[model samples]
Target: MRGVWYRRSAGRVQAGAVLVLAGGLLAGCATAPPRNPNNLCSIFQEKRSWYHAAMRQEAKWHIPVSVPMAMMNQESSFRANARTRRTYILWIIPWGHISTAYGYAQAKDEIWHDYQRQTGAGGSRTDYADALNFMNWYITNSRKVDGIPVTDATRQYLAYHEGWTGYRRRTYASKGWLVTVARKVGHRAQQYQQQYDACKDRLKGGWWENFWDWLF
Candidate 1:
């Protein structure tokens, strides 16, 4: 009887381990970055849910889908687990990350908490939907707080990288590299806008097509 009990306990442990491994594999697959990060249409085609989420955000926030999507691409290349590079200690050993920015949006810890508190939404940065929604909310607020136009991806990204107060203080003018990066983000937004215009109707399929896609 003792031997039988021990065998059953070992079997249960092995089963639990297998279950944990399976869960990890599924999560890794789910968070894998898109194959074509440069092409907005291809990215959306590959991830229909992302297109839907972007459309939803646009509808709710009155911000164009291309703007935030472009900013996110610049931020993380759409990688779900992206984060700041680690610092080095004494120029040799590795230290903690330079900043607390992480996940698809690379949002800092403080701003992320502010988003959660203001929106009352519970979600992690690793989730594409949540990150996009957070971008929408923050960009909309930038327009309200800083008078930056929603269509001006350059200024909007400046405000995004620098807080509203920093934008008001014109701190970004001193950071030439940051200003160049913001211009690149703006160019990418224009590219995404053209691509989105061509494919949006297809993405928003007929009811039956939507149902079929949902079923599959």
Candidate 2:
């Protein structure tokens, strides 16, 4: 009888522990904004700092805010530590043969090396913010040669997708895949902007009213 009682108490303790852990997870999810809310396959979230930093970088460098955001969405969905070194997309089959790209940004060999030299940043090798910074520098330079405004996120985004040579050449055949990717990124960026606007509009009570009203 005592053994049965002790076993039941132990089981209760384990159940309680599980419940606490589950609750903590739920709470974290509730507070953290999702990277891909539509795709809940991964239990991942984006950081707030990157959003602010990317926005500031765009304005400061005369780049586009949507460009970075869109890239983040597609590249790693703003997941900072997005793994890029995984060679196995499938358990038995490896993804890369001769070359590989890693990080939230999915930078390849030359890009990884260049970014390391230029930025003095590394880790996860694929973080979206690092990727954003890299593209910010790249696009700014590419825009001048391509006769496109670096401040125009939409155009610059397209240019970044196409690379400097492709942008300058305007090689439609070479840019076919890039064009498709850019269109998808544009749509996703528009969606995200709309979401941001809606969220601002739905600010709870007078909490954000001061800031909003102060603006306009």
Candidate 3:
């Protein structure tokens, strides 16, 4: 009876250990990405690290947080897994989605690869930090190569959409629709700058802000 009882207790302990391990795994997986990303305050509230990520980009690349935030808002509405729509055939048939532009910045494969190579960053577009950094790098380089001021969200976004070569050739000039969208992006960036300035201190003082305080 003693031997049998000991075996039963040991089995129970093993089962409890397995349950605890599984519980830990599930908890780790349960950490969701940010919600209500369109609203800058909600974004910071949902994932405070985002504020730090933006700041990091600005400090490193001299690109404002509002610039990339506005670009992401226009590109993907800040959806991490957003994809461009596919053109339809006969206004009814389905087609493959346009470009490999995914995640917040909607960075294409070639452009994203170049960014990774240049920055030594191991993150993908789905990562807010990586996306924000990519935007800064793009904007900063645009300033250097194309003389598009980083602060001028209009020309920066035009270069972003049309590519530096296309922007130099005035390709966007012919695309009235694209020009309109770039203007909107520029306006939104200005608004975000004002909004960020108003609440940045409070945002930096949040409970989770300490995690990245040292980095900034």
Candidate 4:
């Protein structure tokens, strides 16, 4: 009886270990690039459209299409209606403030305020259009007054999550899960770009199809 029990326990442990390893592998696979670029733009367009329209206001700024998309990818996995645990719960309050963030872009109250002041344009923060417009303001401000040369969107994304004050490569720490999320999003951003470029000029949807067609 004892031998039988011991053998059963060992089998359970081995099975559990295998399950854990399998789970990790599956998670990695979702973020991994597909063998083909089929519907890559379709996956990205919702997020890209938001940023592309936002960036259009600043014709000279050349906000890289990859930057905002990466941020959106990281911050919310392109789910415009996504929500974090804290947003729905009063889990833990910080020293100074209570919960004040919401939306596809994860705009906190403080950050949203900065957006309003910078652009003098108003829209609901939870709305995707507003999120794009808000980021548009942030990128323009960062590039112009801050003199942050718009070289790579990934680094700019890090700074966006971290902050411009200590944006230097050495000083930056991704803060909590931002590192994990950014790594995945950053890689996906690069993947999306390559896939989009590969499908160059055969743009998926524009005037060719109405916005409603893109929805469902």
Best by lDDT: 1
lDDT agreement of model 2 with the native: 0.59
- Over 11-112, each residue of candidate 1 has an lDDT whose tens digit, in order, gives 999999999999999777667887887788888887877877777678889999889989999999899989888778898999874889999999999999
- Relative to the unseen true structure, what is the C-alpha lDDT of residue 24 in candidate 2, on a scale of 0 to 100? 100
lDDT per residue, candidate 4, 1-216, as tens digits? Answer: 999999999999999999999999975553343233333555444334442453353353466555565676566654555555533236555344344556767777888887788668788765666776676667666676456545455555666766666565534564656666656656766776786677546554476453644452
Expressed as tens digits, the lDDT of each residue in 1-216 for candidate 2 is 999999999999999999999999966654343646442122212443444455557666765555555665676654545545546765877776643555556556686677577768664344445667776666667666777665455556566655668666776456677677777776766665566555533422254644553354
Clashing pairs in 1: none
Candidate 4: segments with Cα more than 4 A from true spot: 1-40, 44-61, 87-99, 145-147, 166-171, 174-183, 204-216
- lDDT measured at residue 178 in model 3 versus the true structure, 0 to 100: 98
Each candidate's lDDT (Cα)?
A: 0.90, 0.59, 0.82, 0.60
Q: Which ten residues in a row have the lowest lDDT in candidate 1?
A: 207-216
Regions more than 4 Å wrong, model 2: 1-46, 79-98, 116-124, 151-158, 171-177, 197-216
**What's the TM-score of each model vs. the native?**
0.83, 0.56, 0.79, 0.59
* Per-model root-mean-square deviation over C-alphas: 3.9, 7.7, 4.4, 13.9
Ranking by lDDT: 1, 3, 4, 2
lDDT of 3: 0.82
**What's the distance in Å from true for residue 56, model 4?**
4.1
Which candidate, 2 or 3, would have the higher lDDT against the true structure?
3
Clashes of each: 0, 5, 0, 0
Rank all candidate structures by their TM-score, best first, as comma-separated numbers.
1, 3, 4, 2
In model 3, the Cα lDDT at residue 170 comes to: 98
